[model samples]
Target: MSFTLEFFATPEIPEVLKECLRVLKKDGRLCVVAMNQKDDPTLMIKLYEWAHRKFPTFVDCRPIFVRKTLEESCFPVLDSVEIFAWGLPIEVVLSKICKENSKRS
Candidate 1:
């Protein structure tokens, strides 16, 4: 479970998620809670992005396409929800690990 973590610290998100998938049991689940504004770009999200670009080290995390990123990393999302955190949009996602999902084309 990663809560307000990787999306900020890890530069290789897909790789990290893929590695997680590789290490988990077939039926294991992965959960992540991070800032996302792909579907809903709010003012606070924009400000965060600006801060991130201007100060990479100070503001490491910008808004991202949470579900899209997870799916692209090869995890099949089971459940996802949007929540508010300090006026910014946050996404909480739960996904299952599957060999099929891990398969590369």
Candidate 2:
């Protein structure tokens, strides 16, 4: 499980997850808690993006499309829930490991 870490990484999420997928064991699940734009307003998300751009060091994270990113990365989202933090939307996502992709040939 990762807590507020994925969004902090400078690499694009899908790229990072691709590397992670290479290392993850078969049937190993991944859970993430991240600032999410899935259930939030565009303005709110844009404000976060603005903050991230304005103060890259201070605001290391920007809201992401959690489910889509995970799914695109080949991690099928098993469950997702949106929670608010000081009025900002956050997501708790649980994804199943893809057995087919667990090992490299």
Candidate 3:
């Protein structure tokens, strides 16, 4: 099984991941694309954050945070990519469902 999440961010990422894991079969893959924040904020980054703040649907989650959350939710990352989306840096992460014994908090 496979699924993709795009164009939105939410604080309930872990919960969402949990739900994904529940339905995914063994060895299933999941992909997520989200806004990326840089160590040195650029004008575009600042503007993106500002615009995201104005909208409740956009959470502006960083890549590291999302990776950690995925691990916590029992998904092991397989690959990741950083690319530009509409002039804003975005992260694309691919993770797979972990073995049953490894799926724990």
Candidate 4:
């Protein structure tokens, strides 16, 4: 079986990965992408700060924490690498939901 999942903005992928694993057949591969610190350290920090400021109830605003979560969830680590894409500012891609939510809080 084949499936596709998309996440808007930065989401908690650990649980999502587990869910995918549960539903996926053997030999399936999972692909994931998230706004990383290398995207724009300032923007990443701002997004995380705003997330925490708005939703202080949850504690998943850090990327490293997200990675740890994936590991804890027992997802296989075939290959892990950090990517840096220059010339593309992340502030432009920042979601309105995060911005508005943060502002509302």
How much does each candidate deviate from the true structure in C-alpha RMSD? 3.6, 2.9, 4.7, 14.3
Taking the tens digit of each residue's C-alpha lDDT, what string does model 2 give over 7-93? Answer: 545356677787778777777788888887655466767777798899988978777777877887899989999888767788999
lDDT of 4 by residue, 1-105 (tens): 111222323355545655665665454444444433443356646666577678866734333333343445554445545444442122111111112222332
Q: Measured by C-alpha RMSD in angstroms, how accurate is candidate 2?
A: 2.9
lDDT of each: 0.75, 0.75, 0.66, 0.41
Q: What lDDT is obtained when candidate 2 is compared to the true structure?
A: 0.75
Better of 1 and 3 by lDDT: 1
Strongest candidate by lDDT: 2
- Which of 2 and 4 is the better model by TM-score? 2
How far out, in Å, is residue 13 in model 4? 5.0
Clash list (residue pairs), candidate 4: none
Off by over 4 Å in 3: 1-11, 55-64, 101-105
Hey, what RMSD does candidate 4 come out at?
14.3
Task: Give the per-residue lDDT digits (tens) of candidate 1, residues 1-105.
Answer: 544544544467777787887787767788888777666577888888889889988987767677887877777799999988888888899977756844433
- Scored by lDDT, model 3 comes in at 0.66
How big is the positional error of residue 93 in model 3, measured in Å on the Cα after superposition? 1.0
Provide the TM-score for each candidate, comma-separated: 0.78, 0.77, 0.67, 0.42
Candidate 4 structure, TM-score to reference? 0.42
